[model samples]
Target: MALKPATNPDVEAATIELTIDGRAITAKDGVSLYDVVSGTGKIVPAMCYHYTFDPFGSCGMCLVMVEGKKAPVRSCTAKATAGMVVRTEGDDLFQARKKAVEKHLSVHPLDCPVCDADGHCELQDMAFLHQVTNLANAKQKLIPEDTRSLVLDFNMNRCIACGECINICKDVLMIDALQFAKKGGFTQVVAKGDQPLACEFCGDCLAVCPVGAITNKYSKYRYKPWQLKKTTTTCNYCGDGCQMIVETKDREVVRVTSPLSWKNKWGDRSETAKG
Candidate 1:
């Protein structure tokens, strides 16, 4: 099922003045700095921070430096107060984000050529932004592939521990199948036991993963990023999501819409298409 959004519209009433990317703006008291920045159409790399869920700062990809604040704060968790200055991009901020991406890439399986998420992976974009060319893979490249009913190409090293999989499995989908297992270098979220993935097949985790760790087995080697285009429409397949379109070269559909079609689908939630 599609996760419901936090419908507290009054949450934005508590006003605070802020600046992002040299653009002045006003936002609510409790809204995360990430939301404020994103509201302005300024891109700050993020993975785990979802608008509908409580902020989990485990993914340090959205760190932004604040003026008068000694240390950079996690944009996903930090509330925007009155007169706060948030800088999304700069030399210093870039370096800090570079290190974060570097850490994520250190364990990432550097398989952009064959990985299923070659075109639209979030981590891949941020890595290029940070000027990260290649990573030192710690494991053998010949490991056997993981093929399940839906997910495939299981590369444990590609995961950056963004917790999107864990969050979707637990919070959004109400399934506790995926969990963190291990302490340091070998840390990962493997499926529990040898049992089937046991997921609702919502693909919410795949939607939020920063890397290409979890992918639909059926769609593997089927599509590329530049090969498809996202058109405005709703999804008719599920109870969640509005109609959306994927404009492909050969008139083929690539991706469907998610249920969170507030502005993207119907311009508001009240007009959500009945499934």
Candidate 2:
């Protein structure tokens, strides 16, 4: 069906065409690379790139090799340009992804066996996907639990310091308890609480967290990823309806992502891509 239509009609409406995985795609000039990727069926995963907050590329998870561009740039924030070639998964991407996984898993507690989000966690799915499709990664990368949330483990060892949790906590949720400190390998996520993290309990942080560093206590040991049956749909969380595909692995809501859009790159006019 046609995307519910662009809510507000007053929205520069720039235009451009770019190459994604080799196919020429046209889209609004200002639309983010994430919009283009999501518009297509390729389904590049993104944990922290939310439409509500300012686009922060700290997650480094959405990195896509841009043709003619030296380094892979973030699809979430980068503006799509004409004649641009976008490459998603590849050997170089695999290596980069593994390191990202290793970085997050390094400090993340080995709690999937006990964690509530085990079955539907995006991080777990990502790890499982890479391991199953590619050669498995180092088993010793697992880390121990650093902090506890009554039942959940808030391990810093698994954090990539994507700052997604922090940004969500600060900007979207306004709890501002979590923050990233230091630089380089020393960087770590911490709560400002004199007690525990002053979390608002939105759980968006848990949902957006790329690894198990942040977790849920209630769902621990309850479900498995493959056990859940996923269905593509929309987000009722708000009015824009934001066209999303919801995952229902175990007859419950799991996650959401962008839906097809005419304004989006892939959904753009077929004639435009060839232009």
Candidate 3:
């Protein structure tokens, strides 16, 4: 089953004119400025913003220069308005976004060699995209990994605190299993009440996590992303026939993923709950 948007299909949203990077464009009124920019085939690096939920502008990577604004605004949270002049790219914007990535990398531990999400981490992609190399006062979060959950491991050291996992769990799955809590003098994601994660084990959190903060215990250290050959197939587990991508490594099944993944973040909760 494919998830749909939450808007009414019968009624179309009103359109408004906006200028992005000096190019005039039309977008749905009241929609996210990020969405409008993305519709124009422009990519914006954002960690906490996903299409499945309301924008939580924790990562400042999606900063855009809006006319009359002295500082860059977060495009994900800012709504598109009529006659809005937006600049999505520039040296100043790049530097601002780079600083945001550096803030996360400064506190992050250098564990990509052993991390399961190394090859498929968005943080890695963003860092490389921004050419992040060195930091002035680099400090590492030496918090112990939380392996209490049977299905996943919570490594606070690698976490950027994007809140994507928590938002997806609450907004998309409606499970409300995860939350942000202050632990070890740093804000980290934990299960509600700081207890062992005991939820539906839907693995939505695993899929939406932008970094290796949350990793699958089953596939941990089993294979890198490049070793897996993906085969798109339907799930036979139930009659819902939810589409899934089964990854294999050398004839052995590695991990099974659904359409609901970090890459495919747009979906309606009503449609996804049915799956």
Tell me the whole-model lDDT of each prediction, alpha carbons only. 0.64, 0.58, 0.81
TM-score for each prediction?
Answer: 0.75, 0.62, 0.91
Given candidate 3, what's the lDDT at residue 49?
Answer: 68
Candidate 1 C-alpha error for residue 65, in Å: 1.7
Q: In model 3, which residue pairs have backbone atoms overlapping below 3 Å?
A: none
Q: For each candidate in turn, give its C-alpha RMSD to the true structure in angstroms.
A: 5.5, 7.3, 4.1
Question: Residue by residue across 12-53, what tens digits does model 3's lDDT show?
Answer: 667678899999887777777877777777788888767777
Q: lDDT for model 2, on a 0 to 1 scale?
A: 0.58
TM-score-superior candidate, 1 or 3? 3
Q: Candidate 3: RMSD over Cα atoms?
A: 4.1
Report the Cα lDDT for residue 121, model 3. Answer: 83
- Candidate 1 structure quality by residue, lDDT tens digits, 1-275: 44453322443355667777677786766666676776676677776665555567875778898888887788877877777787887788788888888777665677888887786677778888889765654443333345654543356667777676677667766787877777344666667774457666666666566667777676667777567666766667677564444445477665553433212211122211110
lDDT of 3 at 173: 78
Candidate 1 regions with alpha-carbon error over 4 angstroms: 1-13, 19-24, 134-153, 183-185, 192-194, 228-275
Best by TM-score: 3
| lDDT, residue 95, candidate 1 | 81
TM-score for candidate 2: 0.62
